[model samples]
Target: MSGPRGSLVGQQLRVATTRFAHGGHAVARDDDGRVVFVRHALPAEVVQVRVTRGKAGDRFVFADVEAVETANPHRVTPPCQYAGPGGCGGCDLQHADLGYQRELKAQVVAEQLSRLAGIERDVLVEPVPGDVDGLRWRTRVEFAVDREGRAGLRPFHTRDVLPIDDCLIAAEPIIDSGVLRRRWPAQRAVDVIAPSGSGSAADSESDPGSDPGSHPGSPAAVLVPVPGGVKQAPEVTEHVASGPWSGDITVDARGFWQVHPGAASTFLDHVLGELDPQPGERALDLYAGVGLFARALADLVGDEGAVLAVESDERAVVAGERDTARVEQLEWRAERVEQALEPLIDGGDEVDLVVLDPPRAGAGAPVIRQIAQLSPRAIAYVACDPAALARDLATLADAGYELDTLRAFDAFPMTHHVECIAICRPSSAIRG
Candidate 1:
């Protein structure tokens, strides 16, 4: 309940603009010094809001949407059910028009680089193409268990569970899971293992619908990272993929993922298309999880090509390695991709290319330095959070690499979330 700035109990003001944070919201001021955070608001929006929480000297104020006095022309209606009840926090930009959403996201990238990373000049590449459906793409999701033996999503910033009628963004089968209705408030964790017909109690009821049906011959499960307070933790976990292309992908019920399956594939296709891997090239896949692109990269490298699949989560890395055996030369090691650079790049390995598919926060400083020091011939970076991406880009560019390709993709249709992939190469290329 403590917000940035002073105590604003009675402050009333009109919000001028909406920016994406936890989600899309309008910004406003209460008197001087203190800023207010409002949800369901847009830029150039006029509305009176009451202060819900406040803090002093920090930054902004946080408040719920009261009313809309003036609205921006770009604002549009959201289509997803449970979009606001807090059940489906999946789509954050639904209220904004598609084109307008792209513009706001672009601004976010630029600001993060300049303001946080301290890099002033950057070519904010045009956003990658966007998808329209914004729903039914999620392969992994964790839900809550209520007293009524029912499960659903908890409200944002609160533990109040709102049972879902249906999740538009969930893969068709998972959405129809009886698990959604049968609340299993285990005092322990639930593990859904990959490759069906395994021996487990949950497996008995998993049914055909629960199977993600991902990639062929891929082992390992998509273990949902739930909090540590269920009663009995299960022995085996499951890896859920929307399609038959599985490798082990996990998502906390509230964590972020591409809302469009086709879009994820599209981005993957772009990476595969551009890199054009040669047989002998060894790649460093930073922040690699579930080894999506890592797997594809390993394949391209063939028997001669080795991929150093680095990830922070030990389980995920193990799973990724186990699954990547399909490609022969792929190796998995558990380490914070953003933090571990010195030891990994200590001269033993000759990594020709570097790839990073980071989460929303983007890559911190350490990994960025390695990419520079190793000075790979090419670096492919996939980012969900534009601000963090911009910040990291500033670091890489200053380290002497030149930005060669910049493309953005809009995977989350309704929300402000967008994905961008950039390709960087050495400052000087050898002339043929």
Candidate 2:
């Protein structure tokens, strides 16, 4: 049962308990009061392990479950191979059951409420779900071709590159394309863009010094299937391909975008379903990207309803305005959300619905307070990271808003990334 005499430095151990950490990692504690953050571990399992990152005063162990010593019903075989150690940060649920993933996401929401927002509820909106096939759905990938010119993602928890022959999450271009197969020890990293939707990748306008988007003819675009069924632009012939999570629908190769093309539709549909925009309503879309939600809301509002789409990115605002020119009900504005709302503070424009699609850092305190001051009847918050969402929710709740509906979209299936939506309203509307 012992492999070399596990010295005091190499104490043999078992994972005493495991708990969910933000970004889907499982934090386990060992007998030595040292923490063994075994990726994808479940609670109550005794695991055999080695130490990867540790110090003399404290010990951290790494476990290779040679045997389950004990098992939890919540554990399941991971759906993706890169889900565990030495795997992509894309997914952390290989050892966790799917049902549990849903619950865990929901729990993270609930915990955020009590711990951050302070509105403990018996139930939350049923978490939106779809079948697996997590990786293959990604419509865009920005590969890092190291100085060696091999393309792939940064290694888990480090900057080292893992030269990949194929990425399960990447679209067809990244897989079969000759970009990664070539050699280029001359450069540090190069990006490869893939096409989204039914269109071919558009030629890229790249900065000369950048890696993947370095050339003007780079074929790539992060596909964004706008809600209520907006088709890809027919004349749009160019796309700037860049990196994962960076180029979903940006004019340039680098900007924040919702990753995972495979799950983009399912995720968008879920958000639309939850928001359920009504006609003749005035809506405010904050942090609005190249008008994804703005255009979608435009369709629902029709001629009678109006949507004010606000985005910080001047490029995205211009793109969204141009992209959704057909929608008369939408007005796109390029301005930081916090400053843009200054006029509304005095009760000038009271919107029926307010949607916040903030970055991982989330809406800071000022933004949260303004949302409350504006007092929109319904606020749909699309958050890419849970912890940030939780922190913001706490701020909103303290202002007397309650979480009416909360749902999670598994847009990034293989990686550790998860997106969530929270619908908040006055406590009077609290169902239970």
Candidate 3:
């Protein structure tokens, strides 16, 4: 399958993969010494990869494993029919065993930390509770609608919708909702949410999954994009039982929440454990969504201490405020993290602990420097992308903070996504 080495856009090359890389690709060098990011292949396996993107002169060419001349011992038949080279792009490591999937994710995290942050650490991807086989854990699924009104998922690197009858990663209630069985005539996509709790009897009796508000936990269900504009989606009740905290938080279904069922509680446990909030200790929760961490911090801080939760989305702040009305110590500020940090920095406001769950991009240098000025006793950084986390950690290091403890979670199994929580402390605060 090898053609001229100068152009490899559509060429096929058999190469031996050396190691696993981020974004669900394996590392391999072609005959011409150009790096090939091969999908659907494992390390040390010789596979023929068909270049899907990039030309010869590029640093690396994207390719899909066309034929595996040699396969890894951990390779197993994919549970989903649509998980191979040309199938659905939702899952990346379905071919590998669940344990191996976690191993690969851990390697990615460690590699990113070592390369980007110069921090050499062995990362173990821990499985959240109730993750038996890395399937049926997704509480939220977005089904893309094809031109013919069929709901399905899209392939990677393209807008073409692949019609699928079922998504194995979705929770049982979502599939029971018969979302894929129906048709969307004029919609582009359908957003489905299945909360952890069970719906009420009336919600159960109604047309299940079709009506967003019909199910008890399934709030803002079946969000369809229409011409005139969709109505205000209803709020969903999510119960958190992490550590000593157990309470119900109401958030809009369309709002930002972890897609995995156990992700929120898992992250919360680690955050609370790392920060170890004490009474009369002030704290800050940046990019707080529905006050997940803020509420927990407020409870631990008691009446004398205050906790500020800043979020760019006003709606989220309003929802968080309404849900935590009794907590007088918690204050929700509807503004950007940068905007909130400016006032705190300018007024010489010092915080005892800081928990920031930044987006995939991670908190950049500006925000990292600003937070460093506060000089919190400890900072908990919850991140979805390891590369971004490593970069931000580097910035924090430059600002007199050292990487204390880092933990990675296999929250999004079968995919390249791995959640990481890094605890950074001021250099002088690190105990020998």
Candidate 4:
């Protein structure tokens, strides 16, 4: 409850949360017109907030709800015990109703688009098929290890770890893995992955010969060493099928894969629908993690056309190459997206379409400019963060690309995160 440097900490002020903002905070303005971002608060609620972070002469400060004077009707008790003040920093909107959380995310996305991109459109956040009321959807989770070898998650913006026996949003298999029951003395972190399938067992290097029946469908855990090499490395094969695209994807068990089971297929269907790839159209898939989108683009473009996939992670590229070997039309470039994009554009290859699924940072102005110079008829951008997407869309708009269609998905239920699919086309082509 103390601010940075223990100054201005514990200063309580009554304010009404006016609206939702990025990064899981609700916006409020003090009487002096200084901005205050209140956590664990909802829009339209009047609450007493205790300053948690601030500096002298600062225009804004971060605070936590000390007490709600007027609570929103949609606010519900968080399902997880370690989900409030001084609890784990995993889920931010757990206090809100599931449907309300999606609505808030949609509002955040729309606001970001309107403010940053100067574009306005009706935004509907459609829910993914899986998950039980926003519970048990995460297939993977990384737990931080304290100095005492206890496993837990870090508190928000702090190095302190709060021990937890179970995560409500984690898949059932991950909870059954008993990862929380064990200690990780030599490792600073541990990743538990529940691969798709039933009747599997938890496998860890610490307990090599452990029985599989200890917890049916238990996930596999890999130790992340603090200083030395990993004690045990694990790889997982993910099977995905969506909209004429079906295949098995190989990735490092600890690497980037959609935590939600239905996220990949759902995003793929939307991306493909937006791009509408032709049978013999050459395409580029930027930031192609494990070649998920690139594989689908290859299937659509056929052998006569080519699908080039560029990724920064070498391990991801290796796995992508191995998993996509059967698709001869697909090519993998193991380099940073910006670096690879320059040569592709300089080479003057006629790119018919571009599919980019950038990380949370999103592809910045430089990358967007290069893609625009390629003069592709259409570009499909899959963004996980709305603010980043808006910034990049503004750059694309400046480069003479117009937003054709946009769709948002409630990919990470019970959380502030939402996925957006944006389709853009060259203004000249649209005019023609």
Candidate 5:
């Protein structure tokens, strides 16, 4: 296919990958020295790539590995039959060993930090506690419904849905729900959530029958979206145990909860460890979905201190308020973090600690600057995108906050997605 200058849409080229880049692509230079981002490839591997996107004038082109002439030692056969080129685009590194997947993820985080934030540091991606061999860890999945009424996942960068029987990364309950078996001609997609909590927090403390489908081995909830309207999702309880703290938080089934079973508890441990919220200290939990950090902070800070949580999702705020109603020190605000921060900043309300768990697009510059202005003793940033994290870290540095420590976790296995918890402190604290 040819365009104004030259489009490499269907062109084939043989290139040797040089290194791993962000977004799960391997960097390689074609004969013309134009950069090519090859998917399903590894560093130092020679592979045949088919250009999927880009033009001659573009700085880089996106390609898929058509054939591997020389495979890397870490390369392994993909467990899923629909994980390769022109197949399901849900997973990226399924062809590589699980351990190697973490190594590549670490490299990507380090590269993003160096390139975007001008901070060079070796990063290690640790595996979360929950998955076995990086399989069946996804507690929630939304499958798209095709024209034929079949449920499946879409390919990378396309809306075309490919029907599949199973997803290796999905939790067993999600598959057991028989979501793919049923056909929905009127619905666009189906969302399934399998709460992995054994109800250690809810079941032991309260009646086991309080929350249905959230018991130790209950079936997953299959939600078929109503056409032209929202689905009134049921409330599901999630239990988190970290350090000396263990409790349950109720969230809307379709709300923002960690898809990885171990992600919430693991991140809570790290965040608490990073910012040791002392008694009589104020804290802020931005983008606090169901007040996960707020509850923990309020527990440690006690009634003498305060913890304010801001979440744009009204449903999440309502649930959080209801669940944590006994904690008098914790406050819930149903507003965007940026907007909420504005009032706090203008009112000169300084917090001793801050926890930022923004969406995939990071907190951006404005929010970072606002948070930095609060001059929190310590800030914990939980980021899912390294590139976005790096950009915000740069802004934080400019605002006189320095990175104290960073820990990366392979929260989403099989895919290139990695979670990073970055701890930042004021320049004065670092200097001391």
Candidate 6:
């Protein structure tokens, strides 16, 4: 094999994978004692690696397993054929068993906390309710369109699209939608969503007391990104019947919604329990996408209390406004979180509780300091990335806040992504 510059890419070396690292690679050391992150390999396994990218002065290089001379017991054949080296990058930890995957994720979380925050805690990753052996639980998926109009996924770290008949990790509705078989010449990417009540195999066993009759009206919503913007397909209403709040959330087929079938309810229940908002308290829901958390906050605080939701996305804000319109106590602000937080903090309104579900970037230190200034009795942070969460938590620590409770969930099975819910309180309160 040759590299991009006609350089030899088949340079092989033997190394034993020591442990799992963030972003799906397993840690190993090269002959020169430099770190080598090997793909398609597992911990404690002896593998011959083909260097993908690296040079002498570099701190680390990346490689793919040429041959697994020794395999770990926890290693399993990835369910998806396009999951190994030079395959789809959608699911990284599929090579490991489901239980081992969670353990690896917990280890990554603990390492990030200890390294970044100088704090350590027992990390437990609870499984979300749905998923048949972690095979088909993704309610949303995006496929890349190749030049020939073939709909497929991009290979690991490359723009090249690999066509396939079906994605095993996709929910039943998405797989049955026949999206992979379709052509999208004019589109760069296509998004598929399996809203609630789609009757997918994962949703076969409905929760007790859930209105099983509420259908999603469509098996899956297919959206295509066009030249001007995203061309919307049919809209889908996601029904939620979970702790404290239950209703139908209307979202544009292309809008942001939890991809996991059980994530919305699971995170909501956990956050509500952690915050334990009291009636007549003022709350702020930052990065409130479609008002999922804001609606629940409004219910917890009641009519006497007030909840403000801030979001930068115009479409999401418009949808959030419509969804929470009946709740007079909740108001949606279509502005960036950092921009809106300053004025609210300066307004002298006492914020009792704040729930922020930021993007993968996580809320930076500036935003965390502003939130600390609000002096909310309790703050709930929902994070999709552990490293970003750890950095922000360290920043909050500098502002005199202590991490009270933290919980991690296996929201994205078969992938390295894990969701964390962190509760923080003033250090004085902890000392009191």
Instruction: Report the number of the highest-lDDT candidate.
Output: 5
State the TM-score for model 2: 0.75
lDDT of 3 by residue, 1-432 (tens): 434666666787889999999889999998889899999999989999889888646888899998999999999999999898989989989989999999999999999999999999999999987555898888878788887877799887789999988889988766666667767766667767777653322122223444643434434343433222563555677888999587888777778988888988888988998889999999999999898999999999999999999999888999999988999999999998998899899999899999999999998999999999998999999999999999999999999999999999988888989999999999988855
TM-score of each: 0.76, 0.75, 0.93, 0.93, 0.93, 0.91
To one decimal, what is the Cα RMSD in angstroms of model 4 from the true structure? 2.6
Q: Which candidate do you rate higher for TM-score, 1 or 5?
A: 5
Candidate 6, residues 127-243: lDDT per residue as tens digits? Answer: 998888877889888888788877799888888999888898898767666567556666677667778843222111113332222324433544434322545444567887678
lDDT scores of the candidates, listed in order? 0.60, 0.61, 0.85, 0.83, 0.87, 0.82
Better of 3 and 5 by lDDT: 5
lDDT of 4 by residue, 131-184 (tens): 988999988888888877778998889988888898999888777866788776
Off by over 4 Å in 6: 1-10, 197-229, 232-234
Model 5 RMSD in angstroms: 4.6
Distance from true position, residue 45, model 6, in Å?
A: 1.2
Which consecutive 10 residues in model 5 have the weakest lDDT in total?
198-207
| Alpha carbon lDDT at 161, candidate 2 | 78
**lDDT, candidate 1, 24-63, per-residue tens:** 5556665564667776666777777765555555477677
State the lDDT of candidate 5 residue by residue for 1-432, as single tens digits.
455568779899999999999999999999889899999999999999999999877889999999999999999999999999999999999999999999999999999999999999999999999998999999989898888878899998899999999999998887876667667566677777776443211111112333324333445544434333675766777889999477988877778999999999999998998898899999999999998899999999998999999999999999898888888999999998889999888999898999999999999999999999998999999999999999999999999999999999999999999999999999899999
Q: Which regions of candidate 5 are displaced past 4 Å?
A: 1-5, 197-222, 226-228
Please estimate how well model 2 matches the true structure, expressed as its whole-model Cα lDDT: 0.61
